[model samples]
Target: MKNLLYILVLGLFIYSCSSTKNRDFNKKEITANANDTVRIANDSLEYEIIVIEPGFNLFINSIAKPRGYHSQSYLENKNIFLVQEYNSRVNQPFNYNPNLYIQAINYDNFVDYGYEVNYMLYNYFVFFSREYNQRFSVPTRI
Candidate 1:
């Protein structure tokens, strides 16, 4: 009787562990989907900006200003300043979190990357700053 009880308990423990592992795998898939990637590109200008972060899609849809709210020039100006500040941080990884400031953004003021590209880039910087609790020298108000 004692031996039978031990065997049953051991089997239940193994089953529970397997179930937990499966649940964790499912959770990871959901999390991956949530961490969306947004790409903004202008073929004629040959410029592209890719933003990969969690909750950014939600932020842009719900929190950010409408697409045509700001003029193209305004978006470009904000993007230039924000990109400069962000790239500075990326260069000095010791001063900033390396994981957060992953790569330098190549944004040229002379290039006309269109209204959509500029708007998305500007909003991305805003999202990144707010999400990571970072502050730029220039204003990041939406």
Candidate 2:
């Protein structure tokens, strides 16, 4: 009985130490939004990025082109709708990427315009897939 008890205690000690020895994470700490900081440390290079809070409009406008302006097709596929609208509605000639219209939805404050452009591209892709010997899935965008 004494020998059996010694073996059991030794086994438990070995198991406990071994289980915790291989763990990857040493420590993790998260600061509150007010504090607005993140810290990570490991064997690799330490990385830290400052948190900046800007208004949504300012952030969007910084990356966004002005409304009613367009970039050429060389940059992206041409937007026929924008071209037509520019021709008939504004009577202005411009060449721009269709993707810009997609980006415009967020910046232009035009929800309907964005949806229309998305629908047009989606249908155009579907129509092309049917006519041509090719297949394309609509991409999931962030």
Candidate 2 segments exceeding 4 Å error: 26-142
Give the worst 10-residue stretch by lDDT in candidate 2.
103-112
Clashes of each: 0, 1
> Tens digit of lDDT per residue, candidate 2, span 1-142?
9999999999999999899767655342222233432222232423222222222224224533443353333112333433333234223224433322222211122222343243333333333334443333322331
For each candidate in turn, the TM-score is 0.77, 0.21
lDDT of 1 by residue, 1-142 (tens): 9999999999999988888654567778777766777777767767787777778888889999998999998898888888989999999999999999888888888877889888888888888888888888986564
Error of 2 at 59 (Å): 28
What lDDT would candidate 2 get against the real structure?
0.36
Q: Once all C-alphas are superposed, what RMSD does model 1 give against the true structure?
A: 4.1
Alpha carbon lDDT of each predicted model: 0.84, 0.36
